[model samples]
Target: MKQISTILFSTVFFPLLQPVWDKEPFNISNISKPDAPFFLEDAGIKEQGAYFRQLPDPRIKSRIALSLLKTNNEKAVEILENMLRDEKNDNVISDLFICMYRLRDKAKITYSERIKKYMEHQDQLIRGYAAALYFIKTSDAATILTMLEKENSLFVQELLWNELASKPKSCNQEDLKKFLQSKDSIRRAGAVRVLALASKEPDSVPKLKKAAEDELPVRIALAKALKEMPDAGNELIAKLAEDKSSIVRALVASCAVSDKRLKTLVKLSGDKDWEVRRAACETLGGSKSPEAISALLARMNDNYEPVRTAAEDALVKINPGEDTIKKLTEFVKSDAHRDAAIRVLGMLGAKNSALDILNVLNGKAEDETVRRAVEALGRLECKSAADAIASKSSSKNPAVRKAVAFTIGRLGVASTFKTLELLTKDKDASVVLEAINAMGLIADKSFNKRLNEIVKDVKPSTSSDMRAYACWAVSRINAPTDGMMEEMKKLFLKKIIPMEGEKTYDADYARAAAIMALVEMGGKKNEPSMKAAKSAISFFHENPFKTKDEDSITLKEYMRQIQAVMNGTEIKPELVPTVKPELVTGKVQ
Candidate 1:
């Protein structure tokens, strides 16, 4: 530890205390040492001259070296040049190259020779570093090109090729030609990228065609360049749409629709890869051409969800009216298309078809399909399904029961309070949570006894949600007992408000509802919980329903209402009728 400390402090203090060019240690070699803490102070103050003179420890040397270059330190150029001579730390050398490359005119011509020597250093790190500096300086392109012939690291070669590709049009044309002629396929692919990006000359077209047909990366680069070129990119896209590489084919197909390449794009809708097929569907959706819509409709049943989703999304974009709706209805009757159709119907506001979804939930579909149908029915606000949804409150599947609870809550049916109250003892934390939410919607005094019992004796896993819902239920009952409000305050401070960053994988919506309940229960007496509720309400104001779950969104609004009560506000008049104001008024109706 003693030796470690000595090494740690040595580099930090050495350069400050010594002459700028001193080759020996400041303590013994006649070099003057400057004050140490002043250097740290100057670095913090962003004084480039003082910070550049500070010696960075070899361990975190690159950080300090990069800092000097970022500050544009001219004096540090000599220091970086000196570090370049030793080849032990390649990362340090890479940082030094970045430093000198930025301060190019300050770098001596002899530094160029050292860079050339580094190109043959056996390590790809050093060679790639040297290639980058050579390209950035627009010097020694021929030498770097020759070194590319012997380089083997794929990542390093890729970087070197990109640097070469970014060079000015007038520089290194001959070297790029030799790369295109190289027997190595990757090097040849790299050459294709350079010509396509650097020149933009017509002479490179045949080479791009050959490269795009042979390699995936080269095809991607060519596809991007073609997309940027006026009209020409569309033509190349049509050709590459048939390429064997799915990724390349997909990228080109994505670009094709924007450029009106529908004929070729329609064929790509049947591409072997789902990703390519989806891209084709997306492009067809954007087309104004009638052919495009026809192609997308055929792909609506493409066996892949992304492809199906893209097709459905495109159909909505085209506005095909009743024909599209009829197709979706027919699609929903098939087992494979049923789930996707339900999602589309929800997005389409097909509220009248909620019975169809309810039937699917109660009938032959699998558990997963039933779950989607239940969620869709909830989103459609199917009031007529109140009895059907309430019956599923005892579903063996927790997710189904949770969904039913939310649906029943949304319908705002007072008579179903007994059914929801029965779910308070459900073993699934999620189901009990939704039941507690449903109780707040109904606000019946008859249900309060069971709610209070469950809230008092619920499992630790659900104590927070139970306490919160109980608080909300207690508020609705308007039946505050000796310790009810105080217990509500304790629940807020200990369970909801105080436990920041606690890892609870249980539903956040349930947690938020619990917080809302505390706010409503605490009302005038629970000041601290009220203050915390204000903060929690403010936190969620911007994006209350991040989960995209309707139940979560409703809970967020409930929390906001609780905050409003704390602030002495009234419920919005429009929502008063639908939300059933008696649930909040706390008076016997």
Candidate 2:
């Protein structure tokens, strides 16, 4: 059995490398005539034959075949047939086969015989192409299986496997049962997959359970199969959880969502493997049972960072009763659990918890603890806590000041503009950047002159972030002064335009801000602004930004807006600064 498996693996898994033939035909209009073979223009058959006989580049020959077929010339079928007969280039032969398959329906009555002859061709590549074409037209699973048994090319075998697997309803239970007992692992694995898809049948459970007790690969496959089988019971899940393999345990943990499986997950949470524990925590977190919550809270002090983090997240989901809350409140005073406790309180979003967080921020707790507290207060958006948070803005610690600036912005309190303006010139570059960002959120035009000065400083010591945020802040003004517009254009055309296509986060942000500023300041009417708009289009084309959050436009949509603005068309309200009320409020809604 082992020797047969080895022979099957070697024969069907190591075929020659060839381009995959899955895509539809290329657009005919996109193909250039110059790419065609040199003999394509010759009217005489003899000259075309001569060119085919001495074809140097197979790609050029293939392109000629494609071009001929695209024009629907009467001679296209004849040319393809001749190329398939004599072409030594495997790539050219493959291309000819695809072209022939596409033109098969048009060939009418002769298509069957042509495909049959190619299936019997000595070259496996041609034979594989024929097999693919046959399945598309016939959907004959038996024929595909027969060809797969003899096919030596892995690519073709894969194509055949996909065809068979796609129509499992057509497969017989007896045939799938026979495949489960095959000596080859690939056959066994594929059989299990097909049976799992039809797992609604009473007999599938027995076969899957028998296969689950096999080797590691088969066991992993069974785990995946059972994930979709809603009828899968706790006994099978528990048995797999006890398997020596951590991966098997992890898989079991992922699917262990029912009440019966909760005990198994608790056991796996302490399975001596961090991955198993993390997976168990993930499952338990969603369980929302008191038992699961107890298990996660205990694991909060786990040795591994990821496990501890997972437990913290799981506790948040469960959101235990007052006793659990009281315990966490007391844990906040412990040096070891303080940070995690603070985070859990924030996630709970209870007003009472905000008091503890406020005390930490007001007192001289560790900088890291204070930072976490500030973040929690911001997340809660406790309007009453705004003054407490702003009191820390003048602390000598840059990290604390940075946190304060961010919290103020998050709160969007219009009263803090005076405090934010003072920190905009702090010695720390990060403090200055965050301050400028906060002021931009306030959206008052009074700071336009100060922001312009920051942009015009032009000193090598000026941080790019400060300049970028300054540009962004100036753009947020309800109406910009003439001098402000001139300064923004100079900063954009000189600094931002040249930084196009940069992959760094700061550079991308700066360029995006500069473009928005240019458009807002009416620089779109000038030549330099038009040039910058064009550059913006290319910049986003190369590096399209994507975000799961719906608050911002993706890079592709941003480019469309730039194009629209340049062409004197109205931009979408959502895509422009006018609709962004958060810009004026100094908060991200």
Candidate 3:
């Protein structure tokens, strides 16, 4: 018997592994050398060597190397070659070479010798990449076949089969078909991956039908590959609905999010195993179909709390019926789901539940419950609860106070302007900052008198972030341009050169925030606003910070639209989903 790695093959129940590039929880900010792209574009080539060495993320590091190598600068190429000589991190080397291999020309030519060595490495990941880079390039079929015979990892075997199937008018059909019957389950699963690419219905369908019964792993792999072979794959994924092993069935729950498989997924919601039912319920949460709601509703009473909660969450996500709103309102009475019920009702736009949610704020609820209730009422736009929300502006918890400030702004209750102003003067910097934002959202010209005070306070005594938020707040309120535009223009045009006593203020953070504010302030269609916007855009050209904050990255993506609004070509919508300011604290992009 051939020995197989259980973790690699996932012989037991485990979530399928996506390639590293496909994984999440990584963002553009995570790039250690964000200027790598800039270096590739300009005279920064010499500077990139140090940036590349200090860089931490492997995916970004690889791209930087590819970028520099693409520059064809002899110095850039020579620097990378020297770095690779001592590069001990195999992942870094493999990522670079794999990306290069995909380029298929100049990069592959330059890196061939080193990659050939990767082919001989014992690690299956390295060897798989090497084979795809080196071995698959050979016109000779026997050499590729010999490597396939010796390979053990399912991942590597899948890559090889995909490579072989992609070669036009090539690959011996009979030889590839033999793997479907191999005792090695990996080979059989590997065969399923390419069945969509290689075979005709008369031949492929029967082989898959037999392979379905071969092993659990094979059937699981078949479900994942269904998208590639829609014709035959659809029939196969449907058949997987009743697999004896719940693990195989659970794997298909995600597939059931599609209309084609949704009914089968709804059936899985009633699965005896709570895990299976939870999987189905969670997957159905993403579907907009009303039928998904009915299936999830049936699971509301599941004996397993997680399964029941999953059903509850699914209902909240799908925004359940009016009757369900009454049910959720009742859940607010119990401690077990009070916070969650308030959150669900608020997000579901449950206007009727606002009264029950409002009670949480008035009663002896926890700080967290109060915050959720406040936010829920804001989402429902319950103007009647504005007085109750403003009362919490002085709450002991800064977070609750912050929520109150944010909600008051969203409700835009002019009567509560005094409450927001009082909160802005509160001692806590974060709470005070949020209050200014709330005041801006109200945007009544009466607050224009307060603008001069906020402008004067943007000094060394204040923290950098507070100053940034204050600058942004005035722009949001669109305060009078007479005396204010001069100050705003000065800050917008000048860089934060960092005074000696400014211990708390970060010049860089303030700098980035100022660029954003000036752009927004410049965006009005009037001549004064157009001049303000054009001057700011010119200042940005000269002062573009080479390395940027995460916030700056988002602003750059919208530079064109921001310019359009400034140029009076496109009217900015009154409210749009993507362009909205951070709605709640801690939810910043």
Candidate 4:
């Protein structure tokens, strides 16, 4: 009687299981909900059904169906039924079946009869989807495994294998071993992954090795599996490292760092392929051995920039002692390695290393090299070099002066404030900008009058950038007098606001600085100033200046603060005025 029922069900539904590929393409855009008020009891179902009908792509429709079914939406079953009746695409039917199978437990009675019918259908695609759904609903691994072995469609086999692997408790050793030996590469890969995750027993190593000999993906799987099985031999990894495929070699280098074969990884650092070399470098970076350090240093000048950067990073990770420092210092004399060595000295943070950088600064080094030296001194915070750095503030070259101003600010020596103040009047606009930024760092009240003078000197000849920096410098001073506040407001309303519509880069900068200054003065209380602040926000938000210049950093920061104040929140600490010096470019030391 049961056999007869199965036969009857197949006879009724087999015609519906025909692949839809031969039919006219279903127009997804044409699908719409019935306009007649056929109301669903659940409002959420109506909404979801409406959304499902709007999505022309079947893939998205399947996803929506799954989500609805997971929430126990019986209406979702009706929606899928409508789609199945209206659509004839095989792929669409397959996707719909998968969605139904996923929700089978919640709606088993809803889909059980159809599943049984489809499982017996002549169409391999339908049968595949039905078989997968049956196994998922029943946890009938034995039956599914039987179906999987006979399944010829790779897609169906994949669906069955994935369903089997998802329930690891249902997987047994014999079935997994058979999957590994299967002609399908995906099945083999899936089997290896499951075995590695579920069973780390030593006896599984040989089976994994045999599977590893199959192809690139399977070999990659074996490499990952080896990570779980510490007992796996290094011989397999060594063989994989020498594989002709660079992708396999790179993976082996990346994942096999724990293997005792450090020498093999070191050899791979010099690989012809750049990615393999980078992977080797990354692995070597974590290795504490002296051999890894030597290999990294050798590749520090690799032809590929990324490879060289990787090697440099690895060397830093080694955290070399005085011997390596001495070698690096000697290597610094070579023009090729001068910049890298200077940076390395900064990273080492050794007090004595500052002397090497100082010597380069005092000598006839290139402008770029001197700039690097200035940066290194600041990183080390070599306060003793403050006087020497201050001396360069008088240099005729603006680049040198700019670098000096930033370095002095970074060194944070009280005596250099005088020099920074003097630099605020420097002829070069960039130098003056950096100098005002430096004074903002020190926040010396003595510069108040000087900053005020710069703000007042908003002549047409004076660059708007200079005045913008002056306004920023004035705001940075703590507890400005009432008179200073009035002067700043006048500068914003008169000089800055009038230029807001000019649409030049400097005009945008001036307006942004002016807005920030106004917010700083008013806080949240001053109604008139807050009203102007809102206007400024609307102006910038609508005009939306392009963030393409160095000043954009400061502009974006000010915008954030203004918005925060308007929304009644404390200003973020990073944006609050402080003495933390940051690097800016223009001059060398």
- Put down candidate 4 lDDT per residue, 346-396, tens digits, no spaces: 766756778877877788877666766776787788988887788777777
Determine which window of 10 residues in candidate 2 has minimal summed lDDT. Answer: 16-25
Residue-wise C-alpha lDDT for candidate 3, range 1-589, written one tens digit per residue: 1332211201211111112112211112321112211113223454555566665656556666666544533445445544565666777776655544455443334454665666657777777877776644554444565678778777778777667656623556566577776888877776665564455442246777776676987787666655344344555666787889887777766553777667887988998878889988998998878778778767765778788778878887787678777877887887766776787788889888888888887899889889989999998999999999998886899989888887897898888888888887777876877777666667677665565466445555555555555656666666456566555555544543356754222344344344445555556334565466667667655665533453343244334445554455753322111111111111112
| lDDT comparing candidate 1 with the true structure | 0.60
- Model 2, range 54-147, lDDT digits (tens) per residue? 6677766776566544433334556666666656787777777877666655552235445656676667767876776666566665666666
- TM-score, one value per model: 0.61, 0.61, 0.63, 0.57
RMSD of 4: 16.9
Question: What's model 2's overall lDDT?
Answer: 0.63
Candidates sorted on lDDT, descending: 4, 2, 3, 1
Please, what are the lDDT tens digits per residue for candidate 1 over residues 474-505? 65555555344445433433333324556322
Regions more than 4 Å wrong, model 4: 1-45, 48-171, 184-187, 201-204, 224-235, 259-263, 317-323, 334-336, 363-371, 384-406, 413-440, 445-589
Q: How much lDDT does candidate 3 score?
A: 0.63
Could you tell me which 10 consecutive residues in candidate 1 have the lowest summed lDDT?
576-585
So what's the TM-score on candidate 3?
A: 0.63
Clashing pairs in 1: 17-33, 17-34, 226-233
The parts of candidate 3 lying over 4 Å away from their true place are 1-99, 102-127, 134-146, 152-174, 196-206, 227-250, 256-260, 270-279, 286-290, 298-341, 394-399, 425-433, 446-455, 458-463, 481-490, 493-589
